[model samples]
Target: MTQTLRFLEDGLASDQIVALLDLHLREMHAWSPPCSVHAMSVERLRAPDVTFWSAWDSEHLAGCGALKHLDAVHGEVKSMRAHPDYRGKGVGKAILVHLLEQAKARGYSRLSLETGTSDEFAAPRGLYAAHGFEECGPFSDYEPDPFSYFMTRTL
Candidate 1:
């Protein structure tokens, strides 16, 4: 039998969560310049407009993702990351599906995201494409950037 993936909307006050988020930040900076790295800091993810959740398999953290309200009809996917030990186990997909569901529940008409264009990001890009996201120009506060690729899907 498959173990259920538990999504927890916590207080974001735990050391483990902060450490994972910081790891995500470091990875983002490694792949792009400071100007091109759009991953949110821990403090930023605490904003009122952002809703964040972590995926867990029993007591183990599988991954995490967040959705940011851009407008009444638009939402942005943010801060997605699978724990290193959970990389090939559907953790990312689980987090993404949760975000998409949350977006739809909130009546968002569309969802968008920004990710790197490097080879390191091919897997994530593929995952998004498989889930109906299509390549698009930058959205919201973003500008044209070679290091970044944008994707959006109607909800």
Candidate 2:
């Protein structure tokens, strides 16, 4: 099937997005303890400093991600998730690329993210690595934690 994919700049208020965010939060909690979960809530994602994107494939919400401006020269990736039915279909990669481009367009010299360190997150870490993100110390007010894995790449 030839599916049409489009990425929208904002989807925070949509019902489809609400469900996706809920799923992301649930997955995060499932993978780590409460203190280790850094996934943002929908309200937090709607903040002015965050630019959220939702990927749609022929009217289906395939995935979503967000870029949060940490400072004039830095940004952070947040809330990246692919729909259960869309895993391994490049939806997550598409969202990540979109967020990276957005960060670059805003003149961010560095991009960073915090993800879980468990086996469930290995695939995501690999994806980040493939995109040139390397292991790094915590950034943007994040404290070092055993359950959290930090990664960053210079733009």
Off by over 4 Å in 1: 1-3
Task: Go through the candidates in order and give the clash count of each.
Answer: 0, 0
What is residue 98's positional error in candidate 1, in angstroms? 0.8
Off by over 4 Å in 2: 1-3
Clashing pairs in 2: none
Worst 10 residues of 2 by lDDT: 1-10
Best by TM-score: 1
Tens digits of per-residue lDDT, candidate 1, 1-155, equal 01598999865788878999999999999989999999998889999989989888888877889999999999999988998989988888888888999999999999999999999899999999999999999999999999999999999
Model 1's alpha-carbon lDDT is: 0.91
